[model samples]
Target: MKKIIYLLILTLFYSCTVKYYGYVYDIDKKTPICNVRIKTIDSLNITYSNENGCFEIKLKEKVKELVFEKENYQAHNLRTLSIQSGEFMKELPFGDTIYLISKNSKYSRPKTTLPNNVYKK
Candidate 1:
């Protein structure tokens, strides 16, 4: 009985997660950007990049934006994010894939050209 309880506890702890992954880039270098700060628009949750320019955060519902910032790189705001996975919402998944690019102190990123219903005024 003790062994079984121990196994159950281990499984429960290992099965939990609280973050999603994201990619960052530099437009001029056309390369993966490292050391950038990424956070929820609410300024509550935040994270930074790994060597591969990837990051993760576990956020609950009600998050409105994901902000990115770096020195020598303009700040970028990504809005209208919806993590509508239904049963899969707890899987710690990423939203729309974004490629942030910057040039001459300006920034641009690829987003769904089509209109998004999540847009807010």
Candidate 2:
């Protein structure tokens, strides 16, 4: 009876957690993006991509979504249902790659000279 209870507990614990492995990339450049932050939307669990833009995250299986963020890149929200449904694989022929779009710098502008009188003040 003790063994049966232990097995049941183990199964329950195993079923509650899941691990995901994937890579981050630049959508336009097709290059790996390192140090991208990945976090579960419903949980505090978080991880970051390595130098190779690869990452592994372990979290509760109940997590429904994941958010990916990086500097100068548009944040992406990935639905876990798509992952489970194999939609991710269909999009990428290779391994899982989460592509991020680079954000255009809104402040980028040609340098302008200030008025000579204003500089003297």
* Candidate number of the best TM-score: 2
Model 2 C-alpha lDDT per residue in residues 54-92, reported as the tens digit of each score: 998887654566899999887888866546465543221
| Each candidate's clash count | 4, 0
| Candidate 1: worst-modelled 10 consecutive residues by lDDT | 87-96
Q: Check candidate 2 and list the clashing pairs.
A: none
Model 1 per-residue lDDT at 51:
74
With candidate 1 superimposed using the best TM-score fit, by how many Å does residue 53's alpha carbon deviate from the native? 0.5
List per-candidate RMSD values in Å: 8.3, 9.5
Distance from true location, Cα of 113 in model 2, Å: 30
Model 1: per-residue Cα lDDT over 28-105, one tens digit each? 666778888888877888888777777777765545567888886768886534557553332334643455656453
Query: Which segments of candidate 1 are over 4 A away from where they belong?
Result: 1-18, 80-97, 103-121
lDDT, candidate 1, at 42 = 70
Query: Alpha-carbon error at 74 in model 2, in Å?
Result: 0.4
lDDT of 1 at 19: 51
